[model samples]
Target: MSIKSTKIFNSKQGMLIEGNSLELLESDENLSDLKGKVNLIITSPPFPLNQKKKYGNEKGEEYKNWFTKLAPIFSELLADDGSLVIEIGNAWEPERPVQSLLHLECLLGMVKHPDANLRLIQEFICYNPSKLPSPAQWVTVNRLRTVDSYTHVWWIAKNDFPKADNSKVLRPYSKSMEQLLKRQSYNSGKRPSEHQISEGGFLKDNGGSIAHNFFEMEALDEKRDVRLPHSVLSFSNTNSNDYFLKTCREKGITPHPARMSGGLVNFFIQFLTDEGDLVLDPFSGSNTTGYCAEKLNRKWVSFEIKEDYIEQACIRFSDPILKSPLKKMKA
Candidate 1:
């Protein structure tokens, strides 16, 4: 089980390793002291899709069993009050309008693992409005369906409540909320849905209102896409000219097509972890999680099997990009 892994890049803030995560997680000598010590584990493992990806994936029932078998190993590595956030893409049964429930079943299997004892904290939908309509036969040719434009993000932990503070991820107060705050006194009465409204507290401002679960985030440019203080995370899978992509083009290596969105990665890292908290990403394709964690001043460890992708991911942490975590976080 001891597979050779090379640390492509390292700094005071973070590090990246090139290797199969499953093999490394089970028996990596370097990670022996890290067991039960990671504060946050955020990852997007290759989905159980029918389509071919350069990183490869498993599909159908086989995918579920394979993913479930890793649950116990993940559980053993998580500290109490630590969070495991996984992003899963949906799959469809071939040549049909029916959507496969493989993602849901996978979540259930992980939660029910004998040694995991993981709890479902919340399920957030990452809406990508610009995604092209898929399954050409069912959508374009037959004209029978709308595009599946959203994916699922499962926040899991060992306990009902993990180490999280809503205040840390509060959204900006809107105009309506500002108006309410201006009018300190409110008409207390039974409103819609037969719920009674209070007077004093309703008009008070508590920094900013918490964000809802279903988040809609979009932008063409990575610099424009800022992760506001929010519990939920979303990003368009449309960043084609990022640091990793540019490096891949320069080096003649095909970039990881299924890289996790940068905005998505930043949200969970900031919300679930503190400045010095340790983060781990098992299937760290292109090491987006590692890059973002470094920006936020969180210590991170990334593992990837693809040598080319891992090599390209290191470009994000080189000289100019990561001279300092504080500089990157501000940018």
Candidate 2:
């Protein structure tokens, strides 16, 4: 898990530096090199749950202390207008789960800079827990119960808002359906002739338009292998790792554990950032933020402590689908 031995290696699209982000950030050479250059900060730091998870095993006071020590450096590296999006969930204890939103709020408040403004944009929920255990209290008495589901995603910004392009992320309606609807127009006063209507088309001469916002995405088709996942994501635990397995089977791509869903990342990036912006992820667990940033044509820097995870990230970054366009763009 140590990153001391890591080094930056040139790749097809960009360079992948292998080192600790904090250590690198503290170095005069590194800070001088990247100061005032980053444009966005999208990361999911470890929840201070004090659980024996794969990532690390720091518990209670130790966990909070670690986070407090790490927050300032990330704040310093962020640009004046850059956005910092941090995703954290409630730390589940067998007895009680602790919500991290207040901790996150405090973190932001403490990290606020005089020159760079900061604000909480949204406290939206990421509803991923689909399966629920029967209600514990009800089951004990009446043999019936319900389990709660959902996580929180906090969007925080510094200085100005992140640049975003709405057009690129637009969802268009089906052309055929639009045509059919247009032909059956209900405008009696301005009704056009059948031939004129046919030629003019139903909705418009151009393709049908789509609604704005992220809630319009359709559900996944298990049979057809198509999933137009919504912004408020819901995934069954059974298929949680299905996409990664499918990619591995079809294209030899190994998925990262802390990888955030592409759909989720796309929504945030589209709403909070523009193309060619620099995104920063200080506690990059599996490089999901970096992956999405690259996909959206944004430059990124990630800090990961584990060497094995970094290697995995390097492999994922080398995937043809993700790497090819970046190569083309650079070329």
Candidate 3:
């Protein structure tokens, strides 16, 4: 209930709170004024799995109930046109080859919650092609299944078409498309689909192409990468040489193992929120959401149960990004 105990870091643009999110939301005075004020809520909460992870996870019915309880609070925290995006990984039955339906059940439970009027806007698959094969029995030893490469990212909101701009996160034109842009003409006609394409146009360049839900990136490095239509979100599963790791090693801090993809978060931040909008991540592991949100010039608040990861996420503030188009932050 006390504001002094939970407040950790308070900068000009953001603040980090250290405590249970339920308590912080229900009682902490410092965060009290923010009820129903956040423009974007992005988090990758611990998944429900047969095996427990060091980062923490619930399984089966417990996981469903736990996640469902938070839905109403999340709805209460969003502004009228705001959006909430959660990235939840899949789970497999213990020693079984088949995947668990807990994730899907949890999603349905949240959607059906009486107090939460959230709509399932879209589902994104964060394709991590480089992830190692799991369920050693089924995926490696018996070799019955392939590597588990993608996780589900639910983009939910009160409105089906919540505040979003495709133009904000468009990808660059491919070489073939660039040549066509110069020509300034397109052959438009109706064919196999039976839908007519008006013959007069298709000449204007709408900047870059509207990005598809699928996303992929080679690694954690921030250089812009090509996006393929088939992939919603893609990035290297584990990055060893990033500055965040370097800082953690120097400080003798163990990095959070299950971190959200940097590239994935960057796209949503640009697509969903404008500069100076507020972004909140209630289950922030290593607070990657906070780091990315602040970098994009948005006001942010992050709540983490672990003090160690919260401390480490602060290091991101001082790290330099090369060739960044983001507004320069004053020293």
Candidate 4:
């Protein structure tokens, strides 16, 4: 379709469109054809920070109004079985040690809106164990509160049963489960909870174990049995020498301050959409959603208001001058 965007950078499986996401998505001149075509819309928009940063954000109730307004637009763009995944960070009250409930309010506003009429499917915690402490005065100096290190990831959809396959994101079997499978035997009896444990249920090897939504620190801890996958995704965004950062630094372009992790994008994309399905990232900060979508063979489109961020994001698709670790991007 003839999308009237400011600039377009084409990749193998997707293109980055530079423009205001809200304006571009709401455009009747072109975006009319996009309705009911997108299988997934995963994005990490600017958080409602107490004070504005270089990227952009609105505070207090104003942020709620600004954000919830996109609900109808997103609802219209998604297919009947399409899913929407959003990652929002925690916000604190201005000049106070107290936390704000703006994040939860925004989430509720989206699903409860009559025009949007969306269903809340599931919630995830994107944990960064290596994340730097935030609200420094409260956490570091005053010691009044602990460090805030997790963001909320909400998954919603137009239909209750959106397109999803948990088997696709299953984790490897635990050591105990593996040993049980090898032994091919177990006590078949009732447990204290009045639940029956059948040998047949534990015998068959389903390749891997089913993962739960509550991710624990033990998953990352070596002392414990690491489950393959969970809702509390733990990863560090402290990579200073990665290809994207290196390129940006070399070119003197400041990288998007709040770039979402590639792993977070990959998980939701693989779980929610399949190959050739269309994905959209309205915020497109550093285009992590688009980059991950392209690698997974999904058709994608990214919208960003800032041209400079888009320029830096292009480095993700292009060849790097340095021998970086991301071989898939090169491939």
Q: Cα RMSD (Å) per model?
A: 4.9, 8.0, 4.8, 4.1
List candidate 2 segments past 4 Å from native: 1-5, 69-71, 92-94, 97-117, 130-148, 165-168, 171-256, 323-331
Q: All candidates' lDDT scores?
A: 0.77, 0.53, 0.77, 0.80
Give the 10-residue window scoring lowest on summed lDDT in candidate 2: 225-234
**What's model 3's lDDT at 5?**
44
Query: Between candidates 2 and 4, which one is better according to TM-score?
Result: 4
Q: Which segments of model 1 are wrong by more than 4 Å?
A: 1-3, 6-8, 219-236, 240-242, 246-253, 319-321, 324-331
Give the clashing residue pairs of candidate 3, or none: 213-232, 214-231, 214-232, 215-231, 215-232, 215-233, 215-234, 216-234, 217-234
The collision pairs in model 1 are: none
Q: In candidate 3, what are the lDDT values of residues 245-326, reduced to their tens digit?
A: 8888898888887888877887888899899999999988787777777667889888888877777676665577722222
TM for every model, in the order presented, reads 0.88, 0.65, 0.89, 0.91
Best-matching candidate per TM-score: 4
Deviation from native of the Cα of residue 69 in model 2, angstroms: 4.1
lDDT leader: 4
Q: What TM-score should be assigned to candidate 4?
A: 0.91
Candidate order by decreasing TM-score: 4, 3, 1, 2
Error of 1 at 161 (Å): 1.8
Instruction: Tell me the RMSD of model 2 versus the true structure.
Output: 8.0
